[model samples]
Target: MSDPVSEAGTIPVNDSTPILAYGPLVLDVPGRPVPLAMKVSAPATGTGLPIILLSHGHGMTTFLSSLRGYGPLADFFAAHGFVVVQPTHLDSTALGLRESDHPEAPTFWKSRPAEISFIIDHLDDIEAAVPGLAGRLDTTRVAAVGHSLGGHTVALLRGMQTRDPADGSTVRVPDERIKAAVIIATPGEADEQTNQDMLNNYPVNKYNDFSTMGMDALVVAGDKDLNPMFSDRLSYRWDAYTRAPGPKTLLMVHGAEHIFGGISGYDASETTDEDPERVSTLRALIWAYLRSQLYPDDPAWNRALAAMGDFGTVEAK
Candidate 1:
């Protein structure tokens, strides 16, 4: 599966080098029932490489939501000068462990963001774990990208507020270390338009306070991602972009669904809008957005927008 978007002029990458992927490097997180299992993908040759903490969605698939999933994204970013780290959150079905007695049981929403921060705190150990990746990572330059429930985790890291169901206290979990972020297909607020069934199934949606999400981010939404299971409003998916404060960009992909043309994995059976071209276009646009955000002088974003004349719409403030 070749990514058409990674061609010479599409992405802002000067190096067409091969990427080195090393994985399942378990980290001994104190107090965490299970050790943090993750994968690292980076360019075969590069110095001062930026980092992208990639978060997988809480999907039903055994592997798609685990450390082994998201090869499509991890490979592309690694091939283009960024170090991508994927951590399997507690909510991942692949873990096959359940703590129904826990407050945030199924989703483990609180632990998800903490896991990201924990990874950041232990980048040194990670670099040492990999064969030749030591002394190459630049801790100053970091970005986060997430899909589905993973997007919710990134949203919380970007300062989105959530309520602790136990005591009904407001919870704001943000990471100042994350310079930029890309949130894809996350759930919206539990307002009037929200379906009662959704709230009953996932009560945490009731606490998503996007008003405090004041960070530089690009929110990717699909025009056709209408989730009647959650809400009747089509805009519900992009609420993080629309409701959050600016220094933000919104990329609304046309004719896309929840998975945004199978971003979860290559030829993923879960994607209803399974179009290869659409996935390629999305990868290009997302890469361009991250490039431009990380490098102010980069024009990759403008070039990508021009290329996507009718495929999608982009708005920034």
Candidate 2:
């Protein structure tokens, strides 16, 4: 398939090259149109490959920029023969929300499941419009990787039920293609202090119902995060739960912070310099998790998963 250039026009998309950039595909959802940036890369042979939908953290604009900032996380996956798709949620960002229109706009963190569904629906269109990706995508083995608010969305996407506090009605998310999920620095039920404490005031129905969703999950957080309590609470909730059918793992990156190794770029900043080793370890861990779940029978993936524990501070409850 011909590689579609991004809005930036800087990155090249050649089949012979290691990475291909496509988009800004305008994805239309219920009441909004979201501009998305996607990066697709595969092995040299270009055969069918497992698909991984990469959702960025809040405030992130382009997936390619993220690759430039973070150390080869996506590249590592592409090298392993998986096609990576990173979708940007720029229109739905917290900063983009109109305060008057959405009085409780901040609470839309829970709306991530809907946003993800919209992206998945549009990706089908992308595969059709672009060449080479038509039947190459394995939707059944798909998994989502979300950071910060995106992480909170992954948890909600995993089928943790939620209720409307005012009307007592249940909200149903759209896509069921997500077979597994990884949440980084997710927030928990909020404490009582903040004014717009969505976590505190929001209605979380239950955590025990994810078994029906049938998706394996992994939750990773930083031990030295400014919001360590919130991250810890989220990890604890997943650890204590007994109903999820697939395996669950919780990891804490020692000396890491809330931004998950300082957003993909800005590595030279003081904040990012705090724990470079932890950042490297975090990326390696994610690669291992993706391999085990997405390419289970591959012996190389199994070996990488086995060696993962030796690289970081890992704990599975």
Candidate 3:
């Protein structure tokens, strides 16, 4: 169950450690073991660390392909005292079954929760095996951060339902341990049928069902995304529709594209390059949200969240 890409052993803690691998964690899908790639760094002294599960977007290639597109967002989080687990949801990408060898290729989405569950199930083992991460992981403060289609996956991980028409049943997420989520550029409007199915399975009226599962959430998008309608207006609409009680925030980054604020690999135009100001804003918002939820008494958290909109001033509804 070793990762085919990395050397099989515990990676020592280092400031520049690029990739750490964890495996032997069997997925629910037969014969497919879950592989987690992460950036591990020493936590800041006296600060309790939290875990962030970063999910990649869908594309015509593997999750690694998308990873190559995102910059060091994961490393940034790790350096800031968080253990980031970036799972390779290869089957869910555009390349689909071609990238995964899972026996149940067609029903990949139904099993994504299992992939997440596999990782959650192994946190104790991972902390034990990797010295640097020992006692540093605050599992209760976990967050799911995803981009594009990956954002949808994050929602599902928080118990949002996606109906299986074939079986007339719903696919519920197995891992309810995620305390908060950040969904970037999520598709605002699904097809009519899918929308109806989602309503039937997990109605918007019961959005509390999903929000209660998490501590807080931030949904961010860009004004000039690929789908202008969804990325802009619709995103705001959806956010308004489900403004759950646990401190939800919606942000629209001006002049940014769909892939902005992501890791370096996806920005073909370099147009979506992380604006230092925008990145600072994003870091501030995310850190604030996590802090407010995980360590409510910290004034710095509220300060950061308050100052989030100042960095990249915009007229987002």
lDDT of 2: 0.53
- Residue 51 deviation, candidate 1, in Å? 0.5
Best by TM-score: 1
Model 3 TM-score relative to the real fold: 0.68
Candidate achieving higher lDDT, 1 or 3: 1
Q: Write the per-residue lDDT of candidate 3 for residues 1-317, one digit (tens) a residue.
A: 85342110121122433434343222244545444443333344423568877776654444433334344566556555567676566454434464455543433554555666667777787677665556766777777787765666676776555555445555667355877677776544443323444334333212212433243467776655654333224443234225434455666666666656443353334435544445545654665556556667756445654544434332222
Q: Report the lDDT of model 3 for residue 298.
A: 56
Q: Candidate 1 — worst ten consecutive residues by lDDT sum?
A: 5-14
Ranking by TM-score: 1, 2, 3
Q: Candidate 1 on 1-96: residue-level lDDT in tens? A: 975543423333445579998988999888777899999999999899999999999888889998888877788788888999999988888887
Model 2 TM-score on a 0 to 1 scale: 0.71
TM-score of each: 0.94, 0.71, 0.68
- lDDT scores for all predictions? 0.86, 0.53, 0.53
How would you encode candidate 2's per-residue C-alpha lDDT over 1-317 as one tens digit per residue? 95542211121122223655454444556554334445565554465667766665544333323323232455545655667766555423433552335523434544556767765767677677555567766666777877765665676677655465546566545256876678776554433432243334443422223444344577776655654333334343333133444557766665566665554544535243354444545665676676666667645334544555544355453
Better of 2 and 3 by lDDT: 2
Who is ahead in TM-score, 1 or 3? 1
lDDT of 2 at 243: 40
Question: What lDDT does candidate 1 reach at residue 272?
Answer: 94
Candidate 2: clashing residue pairs, number: 5
1 against 2, candidate with superior TM-score: 1
